[model samples]
Target: METTSPHYRHTKIIATLGPATQTRERLTALTLAGVDLFRLNMAHGSVQWVAEIVALIREISAEVEREVAVMIDVKGPEIRTGDLPEPVVLTPGDQIHLFTTNATAPAPTDVLSVSVNYPDLPSDVAVGSTILVDSGLMRLKVLNKDATSVRCQVMTAGTLGSRRHINLPGVEVNLPSLTEKDEADLIAGIDAGIDFVALSFVRKADDIFALRKFLDDRGSPARIIAKIEEQSGVRNMDEIIRAADAIMVARGDLGIEIDYHCLPLVQTQLVQACQDQGKPVIIATHLLESMIQSPIPTRAEISDVSNAVREQADAVMLSGETTTGAYPLESVEVLKNIIQSIEPSVSSDLNSRIKLIEPKEKMLRSTARLAQDLGDSGIVVFTRSGFLAYVLGALRPRGVPIFAFTDNESIFRQLLLPWGVEPFLIDFSADPEETIQDAFERLKEKGWCVPGSWLVVITNALANDKVIDTTQIRQVE
Candidate 1:
């Protein structure tokens, strides 16, 4: 069961590492503050940095004796402006001809233009097309095109910094899901034994399939988390959800790529879609973003966090707030506090939301209901492959915290993302009864249960060389 001691919160928290949490001391502090996992954003750090930080986190996790998972977010197929010696200022009606990286500047017209990182930009867009720079802050309307350039008139005024993100709404991106740099970063992450991989700006299920195939060939057991940020991704949500091991609502680009007014509706739809498919979905980007500077979060931010919690997201993530923020620890606590405050007010049934297609899942749902019937009972599951634990978590049983005991270290770390699952790594004996007792001993040592605390245990018993499924309610001595 999830007690306040080892692990308990229903909504998990993920924090990014940066200058603020680079050292071992700060990393340990954040872990103790209730960060279940750490995200390494490949966009900002180098491959060498990824190896070093994963080692550092492992060292800290060993010292703290907690299973904290690590995830790598690959910068997948992003469109950004080319490096500029200085910021380019664009005002309304300003004409700029964006040229390919190797193309020569069009015959020195009164037009101001900058080189684009993607050479295909000239071919992908057409006249009257709109291109957004710097997260939609600056808008450009295509006026004309050539083999080497696309001349455009500015629709919105803004400054464009070097490598600023570019978004083409309603346009399909013709880029590989995993860039060369992304592959290199993924290799580093795989070597470092990361538990999860997040593919940024995932446009379709094939993107997930491509990354999955790459990982499978390398024998990497890391699960894939597809980040839906573009319009194409929204249109192909069902297939993406089916292909991905998990989903992330990447609101930063999503808000810009789609109608801002309908972003909330889209968010709700994404969350529901994940729930319906029994996949873990994360709500990310700009959550408590202001807390990066101020210790206090705006009320609106609190409400936003509250809404995600109410929607029953598997996890909530902090981007700049943890990596570059002044108040990293406070940011973690704020998210934890909000999750704690909101969970009690909302109730949802996983059985109704997700179809129980598997027999194990249906039985697991029944076990959850049984635990609720027995007051003050917690569900205990001893899983070898972590399948039982994951299925039970996807069932979204309320009031009963799932104490998943796995002998496999990798499974223990991988289970950190599911809702209400507190995974523990312990050795399993040949005798199933001894294994059950060992799990009980752990619960007693942690003070999670008293002399008479009830536990609903699900395990397979080895009898006559045959494994027999068993579900029983036992009282602690």
Candidate 2:
């Protein structure tokens, strides 16, 4: 197949690298199969293995003469049960006691015993809150709560082994999103020059800012991806979206947090929000669940992928399918074919389905539309807030390259997957005109525009610092 096959256009594929597809040969095959990015899940493998795979991916990208982004996923603070003798199966209506202490034997009477690391977990959880174990494989309801323990009735019983994750829905478990292990992994990823670092379980914008600072301190400038898994993250989605480079709809844990039936709606809302902001959003997890073992995807799975494409997600990720699948190559091919089949059906109109409340008051939108109308060779947005770039992105002008110049390196690096948006970090200009001139000169130097090409510049006007107020169309001379 041709390397620049239409099958891969406009759709970014993130394949998880694992024992099955860790070799140089398999990595090369995946890249040729249209994998645009490689995911090194730090939760599963050692730092040495991850480092080896990262090196292999770079080698493959060099051989192909294409830039393939590498993402290192940090395993955030996950609360889990202690060691169990074997898989413990519970039937419906079974009573279970989760305690803080590590007790080897089963509970004295009607209670099944399990241990939690946090001693005050029971006090933190209130009655009526749901306890999800093993990534929502089992569900329990808190019937009573005390200072150190909570009594729960099993809602959905399943076999669970040692270290299965525990989630308390609607209850904030006081824990840091980035654990000690994650901090070490982040350093390793930065040292390896990973393109993106996915921060798992991001609850607020502060989490993103902290991670960005961490990267700066390490002198490893990588794009920070905020994984939206909790309800808090979703509620504060706009702030988080503004703070990070991109957002990932981590559906696995998200499904555990919200009703499964509500997932589709949540996914749609998140995609639209990201689109409106001009931020790239990824629909992740279970896109091709059956492909782990089988060569083909289920009809429902195909439809799911098609729906995500239709929703205009910049990327769709496969976790286990590419990581530990029996048919990793076939899975990639199937994903490629599905995206190719769906691309033509995707709407190209920038504002076709956009529902902008108070559209007249949105100066960024006005500037973006004016930029599109000016018929410039390219559009340049000078923004410290990243709002202007996102506004221009929402316009979706055909064939016009959008360059985002910002002093914030994090904002610039995050624009990697957004359609037509190129992020560059420039020294902050003293004035707006200077900023525009500097942008123009930089474009010329980079060969994005010639001396005679028209370029549109958008930025904040004096009247409203909160909104974009200036749209200047100038021909470079």
Candidate 3:
């Protein structure tokens, strides 16, 4: 399979892990198919299950001799209907009482009432408010309320399943950023040595700050990826982009919570915002959704993916398409094909979009320009923390491959999430010139370059007994 050929894919791919794709063979197949990261959605499995899957993924990565990162997406501050003894069918104008489990249940078990996971629903919602159950499949209008319960008339009818997600459109409910279960799952993921933690429903910068503090308290080196799926998150986008290490335009609930028509604009805006700040942003949810059933994706879905690639998002994610879909491998192949086809057509003048404020930022912008000037050039960097490589990836140096070398295995895995970065793990030498020559030899050995290939090597090496950044060009030998 040639490992899906990373040459044409500047935009990375992230796939969710599920029962359909949980086996070691399936994981290996997806990794070789160009999956840069595997998302562990905490919404589906238990903590123990997540730890075991992480171990399996690590094993698969070692066997394949490739770097694949694992991200644990925390189920944060979700509102859902409680379990039902039987499926409840509702029609227009049918009324039901909704209460928290802490509140007293109605006398009869057959009553047309349900318990919500959030206790604040009664106080948070008001009369004439529209509440969407199960991603707006059924609509409920709050007609009346009391201390512990809110009486609602079902405006739209559907079968209400247990633990169905509840959405209060145009109403903001107060909930802690990290639910009890979220904290537990995060702890397990951190202990399992996950590369990234994606916090869901990030409404404000404080949400990211709190999660960062949580990870910091435990000395977890994992970075935070803020999910912008709520209007509040969009409203507070500037701060959230600054607070979180990376951002994800989670279009699922954002489409339900806000006007679906505006989702495209919001996605581009979020991606641009994250890029302007040099943060890697992911455009997630339904990139190739039709492939879930059919092997071929719809034209509309392909266009959606092209838009994300054209916008230069760090990655496009697969949810059900790779998790529970019938065509997991095809989904990845389709995405990779779409990305490679469109990326070549799009202009790589994104260097103008970014404001080079920091000295290193300005330097990397010049690096990209210089690479363009050199023609047939590649940027080689050595970083223990992967910071220089991340910034260079953000610069979107089209046609110039950035080969990042790191001694830290964790950083090697973490670097896979960034665009345009191909991470290589190698042991560094005590001598600076020796290490640079070693990088050159590795580039040649891996067929990244030939004898006459020009390489741009960037590193912070000891010079005159003090470490300083250096950039120089060398021909592969």
Go through the candidates in order and give each one's C-alpha lDDT. 0.87, 0.77, 0.86
Backbone clash count for every predicted candidate, in the order shown: 0, 0, 0
Error of 3 at 42 (Å): 1.2
**Candidate order by decreasing TM-score:** 1, 3, 2
Model 3 regions lying over 4 Å from their true place: 1-6, 104-111, 461-467
Estimate, for each residue in 1-477, the C-alpha lDDT of model 2 and write its tens digit. 111112224556788888889888898888877677788898996777667777878788779845467889999888888898888888789888888774344454667777888766877787887888998989888888666566788999698789889887766667876888999888778777787899999988989988998999988768788999988888899999889888999999999898889999999999888876667788999999999999899999999999987786878898999888998999888887887787667654564444455643265556555555655456677777665666566555544567889887555645545654666778976687787788778777766777777777766556645644666778887
lDDT of 3 by residue, 180-225 (tens): 9999999999899999999999888888889989999998989889
Better candidate by TM-score, 2 or 3 = 3
What's the best-to-worst order under lDDT? Answer: 1, 3, 2
Candidate 2 lDDT trough over 10 residues, lowest sum: 1-10
lDDT-best of 1 and 2? 1
| 116: Cα error in model 1, Å | 1.1
Superpose all Cα atoms of candidate 2 onto the true structure and report the RMSD in Å to 1 decimal. 6.3
Note each model's CA RMSD in angstroms. Answer: 1.9, 6.3, 2.7
- In model 2, the number of clashes is 0
In model 3, the Cα lDDT at residue 41 comes to 94
The lDDT leader among the candidates is 1
